[model samples]
Target: MEIDFLLVGQGLAGTALSFRLMEKNLKCILIDTPLANNSSRIAAGLYNPVTGKKMVRTWMADYLFPEIEPFYEKLEEFLGKNFLIKKNIYRPFLSVEEQNEWMGHSSDPLLQPYFEKIHTQALYNEVNNPYGGIMLKNSGYLDINTLLDAYASYLIEKEMLMQEEYQEDFLEVTDLGIRYKEIKAKGIIYCNGLGAMNSKYFSNLPFAPVKGEILDIHQDFCPNVIINRGVFRISLPNGLQRVGSTYSWHDLDTGPTERGKRELLEKLEKLIFIENKKIIHHKSGIRPATKDRRPFLGKHPGLESVYIFNGFGAKGVSLVPYFSKIMVEFLLNGIEIQKEVNISRWNQT
Candidate 1:
């Protein structure tokens, strides 16, 4: 069957892009394997507006953070499921210097939107924050697994999803467009995350893959707010909390390792005053990070009919929603993509 676009990989990136494409009256079919190691399924799905050691506003927070909640909420309404949870993130100060630094940042007009309040003392007894913390508004987590499953089901009901692996051997590029097996499309977008590194079309792009792991633990006291410092601890509905993640550039495997668990445990212990926390679950996934730390978007340099919309890294939950809208607009209207994220920047070298 002929379609407007063929999307590879049904991870969060592909799901968002496909949904946006269809919303614009573009016909597209997504091919996915539903692998157990799929990054989106294993992601902690946290979207923080303020991040990093210095606790600065995340890149493009002003533009990106606004689009996140509404997009997910709209999808949740359309899919008949609730996965978006808007919550405040409490980041404890590591030292007096850090607290003083934030004291000045809290007053910045640009940061007023995300800053809720800054505490001079600890907020909760369970959290070991001696130097107090900063409460960030407009931050939360997305239940990615639930959202992906619900959206996949929606696509299946609409006959827009195919559960299969993408075979490049069967693909043929024509002057009109590209054809893969029985499917013909005017264009194809690669959203296969780390798998894109193996694609002959996009492999040359500086795709730096990083391995991340998270743990699900049952503790005596679970705080309502997400406690972040050394490790981010997100509370679930049950008497459980999700804490993670350790970044490893060398070990790229998907399996949960002793070292990863130990590292996370060490960080978790440092963040919260918890003893003997029962480990319920452990998971790992490779982030499709880029060398420049910006998402890779737009058409391939050599193949005009081929394109990409992946490499969201650990911030996929935050980046996907905003970039998908930009990508779809570029796809449909020939609108100029933002130069910072446009693939042409890399191709120019």
Candidate 2:
């Protein structure tokens, strides 16, 4: 079988790129392995424009935020599924000083787009917000599982998805393109998350993998918006509230740990006053982070038709949609990728 591109991995990175390629009427095939610990599958799926302890706007928030809803809405229409949850994010201030600082930020034109409202007084009676918090607009979580599953079905129906492990050894790089057994493609792009670390071409790139754990707990407190402070608490369907996530670099092999659970509960206690919360599930996955915390995007230095589109790390939900368009443009139009994200920053292409 011959195709234009062979995408490795069907996680958010692969899914977004493949979908964009198909939208442009480009022929491609995706090879994926559904691992129990796939990062995208187990991710919190939260996309907050304002993040961190300083509550500063995230990197490239201006570019990434606008593309998110429009991109996902189109996917939803195509798949006939509802997975985008456009809810506000409520982040409580740690102190009165912080609250006052945000009051000034509310007027900053650069920050005004994401600012919903700055509450000086407590917004909810059930929560602990003595200094109140900031309500951010254009912030929410995607139902990643629903999106991935629906897209997988769409790919399968179109004969563009192969649900199996991709053996790198079988791949052959030629002057024309690439060959994997009977499959021939004009180019091959690696969107396989940390799986790229094992590839011969990408192993040299610095990939700082970090493992994160999240919990699903049954609680009566259901807020319309996501509560994010020390730890984020997102209200899901039914009586369950999704709370997470702790980052660890050493404990990559282990799944969810008792230490991670304790850390989450301890953080949760500081954010809200709750009683008798039942833990329904605990899951974890290794993020394909980089030393510089930017995504890796570009063609291989030596191989003409080989490329990579991975390493969005914890911010994949926000980064993928925008960068996927950029990647597709580079692939089809020979447009030069931005130096910041291009892998050639490390190696000359």
Q: Residue 25 deviation, candidate 2, in Å?
A: 0.8
Query: Candidate 2, residues 163-229: lDDT per residue as tens digits?
Result: 8889999999999999987899999999999989999999988999999999999977999999999
**For model 1, how does the per-residue alpha-carbon lDDT over 246-310 read when each residue is reduced to its tens digit?**
88889987699999999999888877776878999998988889999899999977677999998
Candidate number achieving the greatest TM-score relative to the actual structure: 2
TM-score of each prediction = 0.97, 0.98
Model 1 poorest ten-residue lDDT run: 33-42
| Candidate 1's TM-score | 0.97
Given candidate 2, what's the lDDT at residue 262?
94
In candidate 1, which residue pairs clash?
Answer: none
> Model 2, residue 276: what's the lDDT?
70
